[model samples]
Target: MAFNTCVSVIRSASHKAQMIHNQDVQAVSTDVINADELWSFVKKSKSTVNRKS
Candidate 1:
C-alpha cells in the first residue's frame, strides 16, 4: 500500500509538471502574435528559472 501511494504521488507530480510545461508552450505561441503577452511570458520564465536554481 505504501508503494502504491508513492507511485501515485510521483505520477501526480509528473502530471502537474507536464501541464505547466504545456501552458508555457501555449504562452509562447500566444506571444508570437502578441508582443505584450510575449514580454509577460519572458518575465515569468525568468522568475521560474531563478526559483528553480
Candidate 2:
C-alpha cells in the first residue's frame, strides 16, 4: 500500500543519514573548542528564559 512505501522510504533515508554521520565525520584533535558555543550552535538557539514570576 501507499503507507508501506512511505515507511520504507523514510527508513532508507534515516539509515543513509546515520551512515554518513558515523562514517563521514572525523574526530577532531589538537585544536581548541568552546563547549558552550558548540552546544548552542548544535541546539540552534540560545538558552531559554522563563517568563513567569
Off by over 4 Å in 1: 29-53
Candidate 1 local accuracy as lDDT?
0.90
Candidate 1 residue pairs that clash? none
Model 2 lDDT tens row, 1-53: 69999999999999999998887556535466669977877565443333331
TM-score of each: 0.47, 0.46
lDDT of each: 0.90, 0.74
Q: How many clashes does each candidate structure show, in the order listed?
A: 0, 0
lDDT of 2: 0.74
Error of 2 at 38 (Å): 13
* Candidate 2 TM-score to native: 0.46
- Top model number, lDDT: 1
Task: Please give the range of 10 consecutive residues that has the lowest summed lDDT in model 2.
Answer: 44-53
RMSD after CA superposition, every candidate: 7.8, 4.5
